[model samples]
Target: MSTPVQRLTAEVNGITLSYLSQGEGPLVVFMHGFPDLAISWRHQMKAVSDGGYRAVAPDMRGYGASSAPDDPALYTQFHIAGDIVGLMDHLGEKSAVLVGHDMGANADWAMATFVPERVRGVVVLSIPHKPRGTQPPVASAPPRFYQKLFQAIGVEDDDLHRNVKTFLPAIFDRLSGSSEHGAPPSLMVPEGKHFSDLFEPPSKTPEWLGEAELAEYVATFERTGFRGALNWYRNIDSNWWTAAPWTPGHVTVPAAFMIGTADVAWALFKDNGVIDSQKERVPNLLDMRVLEGVGHWIAQEAPDEVNDLLLNFLAKLEARDS
Candidate 1:
């Protein structure tokens, strides 16, 4: 059974964010990434909340039931980070541990950089920080690279909107460690092919996903469409600019990074200066784990391991205060 979550909304940073919240005690915020919802953290929320922490998972600025401003500009790093800080203020929290995955990892890292005081600590999954590049990210990528393609207006959204169930499950399944289909989903859109052509949607989703859970994901996207979420990709270049003042700023808080070795992102983070230098960059980095055979969906794919890591980090934070 899924954890029973209290659905709530907060008016933050001039927008309303619908979030899933469970349990009580010290605050712990979970943020989801692209094409994901707050419920992505359902397992962790229940575990952390049971361990005596308030678990709050916001749908993020442009996904799920949250505010989805049409302008791509609103999805920049500052906008998303402020939404988090503003949510904290709305909840009357002085400081809270932030846990995030994918785009959420990106946003959580931004929060730590801009407002470390409001952050007790951060736990990020999959994505490790890459140094900001000089030109717009899209400038260097080939036209069909997924991120570059998303920069153009309406193409990807229209493609995905045609078949949410098919494409959505393909995303979850193709990137999973237990995926029956071999080879990770390609991010490049080949000539004469749309982004959704990356893989055929499996009739059965990866084991980690439930039919009901997937239904909720499909329904939400069907109603909201993908423009708002895809807009985040659209603003990558602007986000790069907005983040300039704090280009090399460090996260001055206790932190942990967890990823499955099989996650597609491992190709970028593994043995690269990203992890080794992350400790130097984020001086308080306390844990970095590479769980073998796991996949991109680290939290959902390996809940038991992720729960242990989250609780252990939370306990360590409590000990520091003691």
Candidate 2:
């Protein structure tokens, strides 16, 4: 059964974020991905709260019921990282174990890199560590792409805006490649999908999310709009430049990268290395396990496995603390 979601708001870094929280333990912060809200962590939060820690997940700057600012600059890595820090201060926590999925994982990487002392450890799901450095413009494919088309100022205007209902569903379907009503297929071929497809909704409704879950996301987006969330993609170049000073360095904290074996992202993992270019990126890297039959949404799709791995890892961290 799903844990009952509780709605709450906290001001951090000048932004007000509405989040769904449950459980009790050492403060834990969960960041959700695109088209998701803090409620996404319900399973994990319930699993870990009993360890005397507080399990908290925020809507992020613009994804849920969080305050959405007008300027794109506010959505940069530094600011997003600041939001996490601000959250810590608000909760009176000096440090906490951080976990992120998808874009949230990106922010987790930034947090660990910029403010090591504030983070005890990090567990990344789906997203891997993409170092900030010089790289040629990435090539794109028709169906499978990573270019951020939504970042453009006017892409969502006119026809696309009018047909968002149709667009969203189609985009989600293509991205998932599995009907919302059925089980997702194991393998994802690199058939040319782009970052532009991110903003649109899925052609079919996702089976995993019920009306309550979907309502939370829809309401958040409706209130916050998508600009703040899209700004993360918009500032890819800015983030690289900002990290240029810190780049060429490895993460010193204990870290793990969990990927789904069937996830297309695994294709990017070469030489058994997760991040490209830099060697020994995560100096204290513990493990990188690719779940046998999971997709990009590993946490949601395989909650039991994710929960067990996280518990074991956190237990070790707890042991050292004691």
Candidate 3:
């Protein structure tokens, strides 16, 4: 039987963040990515909490029932990381094992690097910790990265908003390795086309994603619009500028990085030595695992494996502290 998750809210970093939590013990906070809610970690939350750790997954600022700030500047890495710290303060905990996926993973890397003392351990999924490069990320990529496309503001938002249901399901299908929903589609969209153009109408929801879950995501995006979430992407350049001081900085805390073998992000970063470079970027990286048949949504696609990895990492942390 799964532990029942409690829906809770707190004033953190000047925003009201809504989160799902359960269990009680050492803190383990889960941060989700774009187009995802706290519920995205439903399986892992229950698993971790049941394993004797207090598990909390927040909807993140500008997401779900959380307060959405109009200014894109508010979504920077500094602000997001601060919110996590503020959450800890609100919970009366000094530090936590921070776990993040996708953009959330980026924030985890930031928190560990910016305030290593506040993070007992770090686990980042899908995205890797890439140190700031000399040129803007947009300018460096051969084909413009999606982050650059997102910087266009209204254009991408219009496309996504116009086809929320189609877009969401399509992305979920395309990113996964399973052929249950048919062959995954290419994510690359041509300059003149919308990102939604890449995917055809999905035949059926992938086994990893359910109709009810997909409906929930669609409803949330319909209510919140893509602006708040897109703002995070818009701040790419600004984040680069703000993170300048930490140019040579590395995550010195115990950390683990995981990604799926078929994840598009893997393709993007593989050429850049993303996995191989972790030794230098995260000197204390405890483990790095690439799931053989998984995709971008590792936690959701393989919840049991992800839960096991997390529990094992936590156990190792406990042993180290003891």
Candidate 4:
């Protein structure tokens, strides 16, 4: 059956956002991550809406048909969170369960903090609670190679064009950690190699994305441009400063987070203990689980398990509220 898609126009943080929502019941808003659109939640929208909750997903400020502004500062978590609240207001919803993944999860954290009354509950997938008033090293590290490149060369305008022709597959491969299979020349790069190494074609099929999937991503980036998405990364410090007053960060609403044990975030920060620190921030954290075989795209990678987790969490929250 075809899931219904609705378009909404609302002004938030000074930019108009275009969102897609379907089904109807208690409102549930889905916020997507970098390099993604509301369409990314096609499966979750169907599952959640069919389960009796209105499932709403937005293109946010930078992706899909949403307004994309030139100022990087506008993409900070504070602003993005405000956009969500504005969206709820536009929808005539006083409160909604907020669900987010990747960059969207970052915004979800801010939303739950900035407007507690407006968030019935929150679900963080592939991301943990980012405590207010705490600065983690990884988040503070010098910009990643790609980020530095984006800043140094003013690459956004052309990057999207090139990506459709060249870079999207590599990013997906690297993010999924499945770039190599054959000879070193086809995939391997020396230690300390920069993103220049990413230009090479993958030796094997990437486990996370295929040609059709990549084509979709490439087309979206091409149409929407990647700058708006990259702006999220650029506003890290701005987000912190804007959220400075709300310390002792704790979500009074029921909240849960889940990640794949094999996710690259774990591999990258295994020694940093960011996950444990993240858990400490949410006082009402009801559950935290690491799926055995999944990766960063927890929802897409393990939908059935993700759905089960969400359904149970929502049930518990409903019980508590009753």
- Model 2 over residues 121-181: C-alpha lDDT tens digits? 8888877876544552222223323334455654442334444445444433433424442
Candidates sorted by TM-score, best first: 1, 3, 4, 2
- Clashes (backbone N, CA, C under 3 Å), per candidate, total 0, 20, 0, 0
TM for every model, in the order presented, reads 0.96, 0.83, 0.95, 0.85
- Candidate 2's C-alpha lDDT? 0.68
The global C-alpha lDDT for each of the candidates, from Candidate 1 onward, is 0.87, 0.68, 0.86, 0.72
Q: Please identify model 4 stretches exceeding 4 Å from their true place.
A: 1-3, 11-13, 132-140, 143-153, 177-196, 199-213
The segments of candidate 1 whose C-alpha lies over 4 angstroms from its true place after superposition are: 1-4
Clashing pairs in 1: none
For model 4, residues 169-251, the per-residue Cα lDDT tens digits are 65555455233522112223344554435556566546555567667776777777677777776776666666767876666
What candidate 3 gets wrong by more than 4 Å, as runs, is 142-144, 179-187
Residues 137-230 of candidate 1 have per-residue lDDT tens digits of: 7778777888988887788889888878798999888888877786576678898888789967787967798988999999999999889899
lDDT of 1 at 267: 67
Q: Deviation in angstroms for 22 in model 2? A: 1.8
Model 1 residue-pair collision total: 0
TM-score of 2: 0.83
Q: Every model's Cα RMSD, please?
A: 1.7, 4.4, 1.6, 3.8
